[model samples]
Target: MVYRHLNEKDRFYIEQRLSEGDSLRSIARALGFSPSTISREIKRHTPIDFKGLYCHRLTSRCAQEKRANAKQGQAFRQISEEAKMLIHQRLSTHTSDQATLFRTNKLQ
Candidate 1:
């Protein structure tokens, strides 16, 4: 599937499934995502004071607020630690580079 972020409807579904006592794996299956994705979504949006609680509306609002507050490059062109090291030890990273350095190390 093409990569896309979760939306309010998805969050609402997640909230509903969670309220109905569904497992994260099951929820992920129904939503076409990995169990870890569902788990991380829950953990990411859970209210700290409530520990395990997730509210879709609040999550939506928070997400909007975050987007509105986001700064440029906060989500793009993030050089990896290995990439950073390559720059200091080797040279700046860029497109059309030789295969000698900056091979795909891995992703987080």
Candidate 2:
């Protein structure tokens, strides 16, 4: 099954509802998402100290870092402007192969 992700606004709303002492089920009903989703978000993103204050920027950055770190020990691929320019130059000169160009190079 495909999962639909919540937006930044929804995340902030969840934090707000959590801060306002609303039950997880109530917030889930209001947002039309499963209670498990709410529970997971809260558990994953909550501050270690459990302070009531919520910072959207911090939460978003933390989530991004978490995603990035999950792919550790993978092969590294360079994607700098210099590399792109070289590829473009090859394509312009008809020296690059289409199969190689379409290959998925995972970035570290």
Candidate 3:
């Protein structure tokens, strides 16, 4: 099966199923994911103040915030203009040793 990230709808289903006291394995089977995935989702997203309640909105928000924060660390906005220019120059010239170039130039 093709791998895919769980969306808000899937999170909602998980919340509903969890509220109904469904087993992790059952929820996983219904969602076409592994039981470990379900378990991990619950473990990771269950808020400390919620005391183990699997809230879809809270979980989704936390997941979104996490993704946003992670992206901040990897954003193009973080790249220096000199590095960007170097990359453009290398690409324009069909150079393949970008890593070596970056290392030599102390850009990495």
Candidate 4:
């Protein structure tokens, strides 16, 4: 399924459910998402101060920033640490010019 940003309605619902002491799992089931997803949505859209009080505006702004940052990178560029080390080692060995080009493309 394609991912989409949450609308104000969804945010409002999250706030409402949280305020009502609903568990993350319950909220997730209600919204047809995974529990971890619901938890992360709350954390992303509900930044808390040192005192741990949620600020809706700040949370929304954070969510906007996250979305903007995500758009800057290609999804498939994500690589594991071991894979990264292997790539670096291969580059050091200079086995293939095409490998270097592919690595450079990923860096960009």
lDDT tens digits, residue span 23-108, model 3: 99999999999999988888888888898888899999988887778766465676778787888887787888856366537874
The candidates, ranked best first by TM-score, are 3, 1, 2, 4
- Candidate 1 local Cα displacement, residue 34, angstroms: 1.3
What local distance difference test score does each model get? 0.76, 0.72, 0.85, 0.70
- Candidate 4 C-alpha error for residue 78, in Å: 11
Candidate 2 lDDT, 4-26, residue by residue in tens = 77667888888788778889899
Question: Model 4, which residues run further than 4 Å from truth?
Answer: 55-57, 73-108
- Candidate with top lDDT is 3
Query: Model 3: which residue pairs collide?
Result: none
Query: 1 or 3: which has the higher lDDT?
Result: 3
Worst lDDT 10-window in candidate 3: 99-108
Candidate 3 wrongly placed segments (more than 4 Å): 74-108
TM, every model: 0.61, 0.55, 0.67, 0.54
lDDT of 1 by residue, 1-108 (tens): 699778999899999999999898998899898899888878776779977888999888887777777775675367677665654554444443454243534432
